[model samples]
Target chain A: MAVQVTQAGADTKTGVSGWSLSIAPRRGALSVVEVIVLAACIAAALTMTNRHGVDIMIRTFLWAGLALAWNIAGGYVGLISFGHAAFFGIGAYTSTILLLSYGISPGIGLFGGALLAAAAGALLTVVCARLRGPFFILSTLAAGEVTRIAALNWRSLTGGAEGLEIPAISSATDMVFATQWPYVGLVLSYMLLVFALSVWIERSRYGYYLFATRDNEDGASAIGINPGVMRVSAMALSAALTAIGGTLFVQYFLYLDPTHIISPDISFEFALICAIGGLGTASGPVFGALIIVPASELLRGWLSQSASGLYLVLYGLVVILVILYFPSGISGAIARGWAALTKKKTS
Target chain B: MGGADKKEDQLMLWVEGVSRQFNALWAVRDVSFSIEAGEIVGIIGPNGAGKSTLFNLIAAAIRPTSGDIRFLDHTITRAKPYQVSRLGLARTFQIPKPFRQLSVRENVMLSALRRHRTPHRANRLAGETMEFVGIDHLADTSVASLTVGLLKKLEVARALATEPSLLLLDEVMAGLTPPEVREMMAAIAALPSRGVTVLWVEHVMMAIMNVAQRLLVLHRGQLITQGKPAEVSKDPAVIAAYLGEKYAARS
Candidate 1:
């Protein structure tokens, strides 16, 4: 027999009174705004003729991709790593070495770089599985420093403090191009690939696991979701993606060194871009890169002759003020505003 | 009483000589008990009586200083919380531990993922569980906006979504209104018919007495007595240790 039981909150069926709880509305795959943004980015990359402008766009797209990669670990899994530059350096070195020594195309070598970086990421996660919060963050920072030092000292393959410069050979197969247009397309493709992946991941069941683990470890574990496994997998995936971004950076610049590629500033740049845009949402990093990269580059270009390093101070102030005033970042503010607008229009 | 003679598989849970020590204090000490399938056992003790510690030990959230816990003949003394949870044992936190970033439906869906591998099926299961617990209306609402009673109900709904054979409930009725308590009791009392054996640690006397088939009175990390609710309620030792003479006389 079915036992008929009355609900305790039958009167609350109308819903909780007077509390607008939607801070950030959940976004599905390829929202209208996202599509518009993607179209705009593609148009700008394709139509822009000025070499300087194209350079900025390429950097913008690359940073956007890198920030999205960091969000997998830092935003989704709450693994705020300050050592992603290590993975970036590894990827740049891997592809460059393979190309310089064995005559392998960077097209194939990028995958090899991604694989090695993923292995390193998995190892770091396992080793620091027991740590949390600041300890975990510090461990990543130290790991980045250690990788940088190792690269700096081991001058044999990495070319020491100088750097490895990819030869200027305009070959499509080798991923080296004479004109900036090809690179504009190449980097834009990379950005779109990461964007598509982020959209897929944000909608999948695995995304739910990542969200749960981030919010509460004990609660997630109670439901049979292993936090350790989730963290490791997320770190590995994030690292592999970051490494791919690094390889693209090397190809674009055609040069890399331990000091520049594995610098803490590079790691912080990826994280800060995510922070400025929004951390977890797929579109946050894109917005962040669009807003930050152009502003920084334009400020430096316009103000460099007049004021030496005023751009750095101004850039620092903007980042600080954004973080202080809008803790959820720009993407979160937009989401909340949109939610409020829709609700007002309906009600 | 004769649970020891029964086959290990017949028992839903067997806790043997379990003890947990933190510094100088023994939170739980050498406690042994067995609950047969389809049993509803309530563990009652005063504050700091090691009830939660015992629950934690059984669930493998914390390791026992010494002892063994078995779920249907499988040793889970050293198992991780997720491993124990995967073995058909689900538990609730003493305090509601909802995933704050997720909606109410998503919180339940996380546990539903244990039985249903896909998020779509898990979402359906979550909806059913929510309806059963009377929180279907709050499906898309943020967990931060929920009342204490609603949060507790969400916890139960999440645990139930896992389709466990054994369920551990820790202080689920602590802050509920009288009517809310009655509703929760009715829901819990119906679990046996669904093949779930409940090990509940509760402080609410009147509610537990009416619902539990058996009661285990604990005092300062030791099992003072275990018997039918009526017999255990009347035990003088239990009256002195936990219930006090005033409540005992009234009962």
Candidate 2:
């Protein structure tokens, strides 16, 4: 009789609200342990690079930096922006233009480019912060397209679609080293900056507010946080960090193409990196890049060398699977598994 | 019961001729009431009598169409809800809205952090609030896992985390059992001892009678009576509003 009544209640509309109220335990220990694991992984990455060839090491570090920068706003703040490539392009172009055209050192151009990206990001956020969900995403994508078009048209500054070539700097202060050592140092420094900023944000009160805002904006506002300001600040910080990554990319490659820098593929990769690792977790992006970059390179090596689009298709499939089954990504899944293990052990 | 001394000295929140119009109709029209400090004032009326609407005006969740609200000697008619909270005011929703993804401790910690800038101090305050609300046992529990009664307690805990001098509780005792109601009343009654003021709205007349120092009866957005609990309970208007015209006519 009780089971029948329960079944009837489940079928009825009256129990809809009650059914929706189903609660789940939050992931807590995962955040702390992930950070420690990420730190170890970073050390391992640095060491492995010294042992292996420098090209692989430098590329890995660059991707790590990019992932970390993208995750600051997308993962932590829950503003899944697909226009981070605009900031990347801005930084690359700014540095490349300063170096190739005005004879400014790449070192000074790095800071200059970052500042420009930060300013642009802040302005974009202010205009688009009122838009929620997909609207915000679309607006940012549009902004990135505008930037890409500007870069393509601005012939004198950006060298039109032919791209800018950064000459080799004879001086050490110019930041163009003759060997892979300089690239390693540059990538490691930016990665450290990203790590420090992510740590600071995770520990800060603003970080708490950002999470709260992402989860529920009304609740955050009720608790005295202005969600707009928090989101904008997060985006600006994200842009600055991403710009630094762009600077490092230019310095390492010694070349910049507008299409390559401002490509939608790059933005998609950033989102994919965060999603594959864990969206909201601090170390998720690093984990994501670690897995994806290598897997991608390996796929390229094994399959046709020209199968670049296959990586994206694979990413899209993973994203779908993650959304449907895991919803928390690989890091989140691992955390859940660990929790279950611990619970089983305790029991 | 609306005496000179009570009117002159005890008025902490003054709502003068406030009205909230929606298109052609007034949801709350020309409602005026003043609540004194350290008093648990209960506002009771039928559904859509604008009880919640009036509370929203006082909490600055919505601005009054035309009126002034002076809270703690400051005009807060146009102040935002957070601004009101910062000025020693806090409120709970009809349905408890706990930060579902956060732990019980983190939910209270968010409120404490809003009121206190530093994390260490906020955590301390959160601990004290959880203890006070008798939910310290469930401190580490996820808010999603809490029962309705526990969620209500968590709501109160979060409100108290703001260190509010004035608390606006909306139907906090609505769904509780009699014993739970008594327990909640005792907890609310003890709030004044900590220098916190309460303005509660409850459908449960017994809980209101038990906890409220004074009562203000509202019928269709207008104050019908204001007096001591005993006096107001016996008033013809109050009796009529609650028990219907037949009882009032017979009495």
Best by lDDT: 1
Candidate 2: segments with Cα more than 4 A from true spot: A1-53, A169-171, A305-312, B1-11, B239-247
Best by TM-score: 1
Clash totals, every prediction = 0, 0
In order, what DockQ does each candidate have? 0.42, 0.23
Candidate 1 structure quality by residue, lDDT tens digits, A237-332: 999999999989999889999999999999999999989888877888999999999999999999989997999999999999988776667776
- Name the 10 consecutive residues with the lowest summed lDDT in model 2 chain A: A7-16
List clashing residue pairs in candidate 1.
none
Tens-digit per-residue lDDT, B124-229, candidate 2: 8988989988888887666666677787888888888888888999898877777777878888999988988888888888888878888878887778888888
Ten-residue stretch with the least lDDT total in model 1 chain A = A8-17
Q: Write the per-residue lDDT of candidate 2 for residues A45-72, one digit (tens) a residue.
A: 5566543345666676677778888887
Backbone clash total for model 2 is: 0
Candidate 2 scores an iRMS of 10.8
* Per-residue lDDT of model 1, residues B56-112, tens digit only: 999899999998898986899999999988999999987888887667887887898
